[model samples]
Target: MNNNSNLFLCKATRNTYEHRRSSLLCQVCGDRNARNCFGSVSCAPCKMFFRRNLDFDLVINKCIYDGNCEMHENSRHACRYCRFKKCLTVGMKKELTRPPRLNQKKRIGKQITPPLIRRLDLLNSNRSKLSFDQWSILSNVTHVYDQISPLPKILNSLSQSSFPPKKRLRIDGATLADMLGLIYRSIYSFLERIPDFTMMSIHDRNLLIERNLHNVGSTSGLLILRDGDLYSNYAFCRANLNTYGSDNFEGVSKLLNRLDMDRVAVKLFVVVLAFSTCFDVVRPSNMTNNIQLSKSTNRLHFNTINMFHIQNKYIDMLFIYMVYRYGYIEASLRFAALLFTALQLCVHTMEAANIQEHGDMLDTIIADTTRKLNVEDDPVV
Candidate 1:
């Protein structure tokens, strides 16, 4: 066979394998066909098994086979402990499982509560409006952001340094590269903590990172500047100043100063940016250099639909939380401002990347961080 034929066959084989791995076989047992259950692709048996054994920790730990039992449709029943462990390992969420529905016949007249009583119940329920799952997502995203953010470390280092508070810290190409590297790594770490992101195929995850990390990093940079108060101390050195010019720095400062500075809102926006398909207001003349646009070859392999779904969740959460915290009119204005700021940041980031050194630095940072993430975890099947 010619090279083209071989390549075609290889691609076909890989796609088939991926489809089977993701949609056909049970994620836990790898034997029966699967369906979406409790936030994972699992067979009915595994779904029932997990629902029955809500205390998964207690059940899985009492393993007779030392937690290493090989599970399949036939052998899954042989070891309940390992089977349940596999279910959890494959991203099955207990919280996603619904409680058994009450018999409608038994509760037919229960809905006829007094109007006053119903009003009181509604008023009380409205006191804490967010659902458990929404709260969980909000808490998880913010906690992950806090854990991976470099601001605290940067602040500590600044406090311990002997440099004068008013004196500017010179940021050369190398220093700038290092700062971006830390930001990229933190963004990568933050994304890894998200279940939906982690559940994607390795190809999809890497593609998202390659195309969107820098744009996301721009938003992240604002958080760092706002949180660390780095605007006063950090300044680009003469070489970088000439390369990026003063206007870019001023733009960043202006955006930072104008931002409303809601930590939760910013964190959720970062998540939204990470999954964004394109950041450009206009198509770039050189698509190859634009981190905002996915390459054609990569676009063919990318799970755009899945990414949109994931992005929508965070976007919804962001808006809902903003409305809950700030009133509707204020939330609407803040959201518009946040998006405008993001666009300005993207323009600045693209301009910076047009410089050879800045572009290379971003590429290196992304490659290094991608390698680390791939090494640390196997892609979810």
Candidate 2:
């Protein structure tokens, strides 16, 4: 062969090699720029998608098609079943996927020492009277509560609002839904972070949420108002009035004004309310009619003994902490007052839920939350 022909053929071979190297495609979705993930060549999105849905066998079985739908970059998200099937077909290894929560804990551990660890040092110095377990519960619950509380955000928003702080701001249905949704989401997120709560059976978790989330949320709302100095803010009171009506709104404001605003005590009390089997507080006989307005119809088949055990831990912690903070006699009076306030909050929440617009909004939020929790609780293979 001539010299020029030899050079031309070499150039063609080099060009082909570069093209092949640059065109790496995801094995599962045929997307370019792929890299090894879970033992297979995949794009970032497919990697995360596989990791999230790894244990959801039911999702894979419920394919809309014959379970062989074509999966490419454009069509991958259209059918999760086929996408997941293709991931497996292409040699993706479930064993290579890590538990996300474990990874999250590792990251958190590296970033900052947990509050429980700090409290351990205090216990060693004999400065703390609570047992190690009680301290652990208190630390975990308070940390999670701080992380999930919407008070700061609400205060910032209120500060920046066009209306004056003292002006009575009108709240429409959409505004009410958004406010309620935010509070409910915060409560659910708080519960999800508590290891004991999340460890419960999915049935029990959903049951607890349906029966008691709003009651807990009502107390949460009161705390936000007390802490944010919104109880007397005409705008806030007016908003509550629009949603809960005159009597209930006034009662909520009064309850907030009466709270002593003990941060730790209130946080523990919120956790206590969360695990309570039922809110059995004194109210007028006429209030019994409102039971029909509640959205939850499913009777509790939860492990009553186990739940009571968990709840008792928090109740004990609260009592001990209150005693530590305020003497026994005062703590007893304060505890009784807290229970009465909770009853009032429960009554007010029930009245709010009875409103047609509020009821519909709450029903939607509950349905969506339950669906998401079900997805999270799907069994791992």
Task: Return the TM-score for each candidate structure.
Answer: 0.58, 0.59
- The candidate that wins on TM-score is 2
C-alpha root-mean-square deviation, each candidate = 27.0, 19.4
185-247: candidate 2 lDDT, tens digit per residue: 788889999988988988888777767767887787777766555553344556667767889
Q: On residues 1-381, what C-alpha lDDT tens digit does candidate 1 reach at each position? A: 699999999999999987875568788988656888998888887888898777546532454434576676655654455677788889998878755554564476577644455445543444356678989999998988988888655444433234442332343566655665677668888888899888998777767777788788878878886665455332433433656788887787788877767988998898888888775332322345545444655544667788889889888788878877875557789999999889878888878777787777777767777677677676567
Relative to the unseen true structure, what is the C-alpha lDDT of residue 85 in candidate 1, on a scale of 0 to 100? 79
Clashing pairs in 1: none
Cα misplacement distance, residue 8 of candidate 1 (Å): 99
